[model samples]
Target: MNKHLLADRVKALTPSSTLAITAKAKELKAQGVDVIGLGAGEPDFNTPDHIIEAAYESMKAGETKYTPAAGTADLKKAVSQKFEKDQHIAYSPDEIFVGSGAKHVLYCLFQAILNEADEVIIPTPYWVSYPEQVKLAGGTPVYVEGKESNHYKITADQLRAAATEKTKAIIINSPSNPTGMIYSKEELSSLAEVCVENNILMVSDEIYEKLTYGEEKHISIASISEEFKKQTIIVNGVSKSHSMTGWRIGYAAGEKAIIKAMTNLASHSTSNPTTTAQFGALAAYTGTQQPVEEMRAAFEGRLNQVFDSLNAIQGFRCLKPQGAFYLFPNVKEAAVSCGFTTVDEFAADLLEKANVAVIPGSGFGSDDNIRLSYATDLKSFKEAIKRIAAYVNEHSSASD
Candidate 1:
């Protein structure tokens, strides 16, 4: 006799391709293959010493048990102070809810708000989990394509077009995942005007808020206008900024009612982030930013190195990213010229032949691109690009 039961929701969801590729690279590495993985989403840097020390201190002080559903009062106050200092937005302690990670906070938000057939507008080349999370919350995901000419940023026109009565929310991730594209203040203003007119909820995922490079200033969409602030949920964490991914600490600031609902959801799900992690995050927010700045500088330097190397290859088109440590190159020209019919095939062949693991853009809702994370050291960046360039040049049918 066979006994099997799985929820339809669980069965219907597709596993994350980003995580899948990372796992595949791990499998090959265990077999002693020299696979260079460019698919990671977290920083390669270690958590700063001060943050670790804070966690240790917390544990020693008996802060190992559960706290409030929202978060520890100290961490919440620290998060509130951070928003005031950095974004110039003031959030009360009641307006913040912390969870296992920004990802978990996002999941709880969706779970709290979304109902059957509710629609969420997501820009293409988005983070891999956005659509899946929406689906799990019983919401329909409406993807609006952002073009390369626009730096893959969704326009006000697109926002206006995608809005409908069933629309519940729209996700905006600047210094976006897969593509390190950022929305300027003027651009966000335009989108905010549309959101304001339409009365739609904006979920701003700013996990990479502090990882921006160069002169590009990260703007919070809520900070654009009072109405926008009222409708927006700003999701942030110490994961990317402080290299604290494993700490599982992230928070959301928004309307008191929404925060309350999210906190209620968190209480049932995880019942607050780890006590030690909250203490660590508190330290991260209160500590000096020298470590964060050092990491950002290294990422910026590596970005330039990777861009120059990839551009030297035939048929590879790259856009210089303003923030984050990712390069989403348009490989369509190279893929076609190299006799590959699709981006997936191009990526698969490269992984099999060159042993370099990169995520295909199809996973991020684009068809003719592939994402490379430059979070590793310069040596790995150079070697990975060298292998990629050599493989592309050798495999090109145009060379014949």
Candidate 2:
């Protein structure tokens, strides 16, 4: 029980705030409270039927053993073909490394590349895991504000300024997590130029690639050019796109050496991604593109349904997200107007009183905002927003 018994890395870890809020919501639900949770990042849909069948068929065929550390050859081939078809880019099997999930693949990547005191540039309003994972790899995370005015995106000048002699990598999460903003091709070209000029590695997280709405398309920085491709490692999977979160199959594609290092690390640590899950992902990439589109359309519909209601809440200011399912709204004014001192306290009261569970943005390094996911059904999402609006109206002290 002694604190000194734990490794320093374990001691330094920050738990995922998204998971913490989701767990609290589940706890309230178990108590028979009508809590509507907007904290979850994964799609609410079940894994597509064909992908489920593929896993079942693999199990029946006795394909339950461990795969190669990176992934199965056939699955890798399918992933390679997917890149070619979707991005107009080519990656050989050796250039790809698969792991239990995109999260795990990224962890392995930092472990493979980082040394003590190396820095990873992380833009604010980032995915919670990025900074934590960087620290776990003994790397320091340098933060740059992705001003909300710029649609929560960091500029190439910001990227160049954040880099130093010890800078090892920089992450670009287009169709970003908390804000759901997509970077344009010209924006990416400028950022890619910075990385190329500095010889800095670009860690592009494209897990939300298939979930973009309207005319906004997802662009991979690696697809920009051969030089950019050489400087980038893409982290992506079926978790969001195919509703395969529990299936735990994700992959990284990049230079052969880095992929090999990540593969070797996986061999020692994870052994391999689950065999059946790999087959399921193979089918996800090769099977009908219908289910992916269906889910995206549904999310877009929900976003359209509740966005106005959300923004209409007193003191709430939100930008319409171009992609992903989350709405990141700056709620500091709302919190203050509602007689609370901090967004965290305001969020706590919402859960306790309004029965709506939203993630406070303090966990994402942006304390003025909160994130609400539309991954749930339209009915629940609408009701949650309504509850939040009513709570704000009842508690407002602006007239005072």
Candidate 3:
């Protein structure tokens, strides 16, 4: 083997199918085909003007030097205050570490905490990066299924069955990515107790906490108790909540020792997050929250307008998601009934024939479904649903 070759780690990693599908849609559009892409998980709204102004001011003031690897004092204070006000938990600045994005924060976290051979329990269908990050940190990823009937949430009993002596951490994503299901306070309490009893660290990903519909509320698992708090690391940022995805600021708050270790690791990897972006995040936490509420309302309205029509598509059964902007509908029967061998093939065929792009559930640890993000305009989203229904109606008849 050549010593100049790619590292084994990079070779073993799987490229994100979500990004692949989105790019394919873009490719077709570049060639002049009409395509509706439902694979992106980003908001269509722009970042608020106040946040943008703050970042511009920071740059104009020549505050462009590298900040402390952990974070600037102002941004850290903002994160601390946000946590206390929203989650009923308080963290000193020393307990927090901000990174380029929530995704980067999570990577640094696994690197700081995991020993080789340690296991991280992840609930499925999870975000595409969870297991991959664990692998990159040399930790084993143990998956426990979150069944469809429970709206794709895991039970405390299932969590207990998956824990072991080598279990080092558990990741909880509330207002989850693909399924958009949120665990209630009662559900969170039981899961928190299991983690506490097992001395397992909990990594709560609350990136989508701001977008929920009706009675479903997002709860921070770390807020369950002081004991739970001591063992939990709450990870979040302004990407989803403030439409600041491009601004690239996310953070982790937890026990001082772990946060310090993550901060040290971050110093060697990506030096502190972008300075201007940190100021933007500071404004995101302190400025008027009306923009956040308005965006949430818009997502809720989109969900209401598209849910029934999406579920009514032939051979598809979709649960009304309680939060976030995604809908994961079981399409295994639909796929087979439509003469496609799998959801992946069906998704490809939809893109090729109806010019619709969707991320198949096989990428999210479930082959029976496909995930759709309603973060685009309601007019386009409704049209996508119509195209999906037309595709299913036209193809599923072959099964009869």
Candidate 4:
């Protein structure tokens, strides 16, 4: 028998749907077709000036070589201080592990913690990588739906029901990707209680912590109590908060054993995050936070300005997002009205016909919904919404 060219694990991984859609949009743009893409997950803004300056200064000062497998002490210290200041939860440098990016840190974490057939419970409407990561680590992904009626949040009772002897961890993403929904303090308290009782690790992805708006606040599950803190591992970075996505600096904070294990795994893989980028991240935490808030205010303004317009399209229903830059609207009705049987088809048609690109929510584990990002400029975002509205009006049948 002929051997397979690739490992089974590699074959099983799903290509990132966000990136695929963005690539198609770029392909059309290359051909001179006007395409407004709402598929990008990162902020469209450039890195803050001080951050860039800090990286440049570090490079000039001969900080090019790596200092540790986990991270430089100064960078880890900055992260520790950041956790103290932002989450009100303290983490020593020993408990922190920095990797090239949050995605890389998460990959390292699953590698260190997961064993064959171990199960990780992930909420549906999750970030696309969670299940694939678990599978790559030789673990099974048990999904619990985060019902839209509950603002797309899974309840504590549902979590308890999902736990089993093999269940090792659960991820909680506040100001969630795709949906832009945040879990409230009371909701987190309930879920944390369940995790503690069941001895399940809580992986809190707080990369979007600084991007919340209005009355909604991002809360770290680790901040509820010392016991909860021990059970939770926080993954956050400057990528979203400071628009430093390309800088690739993200960290994890948790129990010493897990952090040490992740550090060891990272040593063999990425070694350390980019030395210059670490300095930029350090500056991001210690420097003035004015630019962070400035970006947050811009997102809020765009959300307010275009939300009503997007929500008013025929047969569309969008929950007002409290945080994050993406709007997830359930487009099942719209798809059916437009004579498309699936949201994916509708999304493709929008890209082809209306020249607007959106990420079909099927990739995020919700087939009925679609994600639209307001991370682009206000003018383009508004125009994209208008195009979508116009397309639906023209194609949708009133009798259907």
Winning candidate number (lDDT): 2
Tens digits of per-residue lDDT, candidate 4, 1-400, equal 4577789999889999999999999999999999999999989889989989999999999999966999999989989988888778889899999999999989999998999999999998999999999999999999999999989999999999999999999999998997899999899999999998999999999999999988989999999899999999999888999999898989999999999999998888887888999999999999999999999999999999999999999988999998889999999999999999999999999999999999999999999999999999999999999999999989989744
TM of each candidate vs. truth: 0.98, 0.99, 0.98, 0.98
lDDT of 1: 0.90
Clashing pairs in 1: none
Instruction: Write the residue-wise lDDT of candidate 1 on 1-400 in tens digits.
Output: 2235777788879889989999999999999999999999889999999999989998999988889998988889999999989888989999999889999999999998999999999999899999999999999999999899989998999999989999888999997997898999999888888887888889999988888877887999988777889989999999999999899899999999989999988888787788898999999999889999999988988887678888778888888888888999999989898888899999988888999999999999998999999888889879999999899889898777
Q: Write the per-residue lDDT of candidate 3 for residues 1-400, one digit (tens) a residue.
A: 8876988777879889899999999999999999999999899999999999999999999999999998899999999999989987989999999999999999999999998999999999999999999999999999999999888999999999999999999999999999999999899999999998999999999999999899979989888788889989999999999999998899999989999999999999888999999999999999999999999999999999899999888789999988989999998988998888889999999999989899999889898999999999999888988998888888896535
lDDT of 2 by residue, 305-360 (tens): 89999998889999999999999999999999998889999999999999999999
> In model 2, which residue pairs have backbone atoms overlapping below 3 Å?
none
Sliding window of 10 residues with minimal summed lDDT for model 4: 1-10
Please give the distance, in angstroms, between residue 148's alpha carbon in candidate 2 and its true position after superposition: 0.7
Predicted structure 4, TM vs. truth: 0.98
Candidate order (lDDT): 2, 4, 3, 1
TM-score of 1: 0.98
TM-score of 2: 0.99
Pick by lDDT: 1 or 4, better one: 4
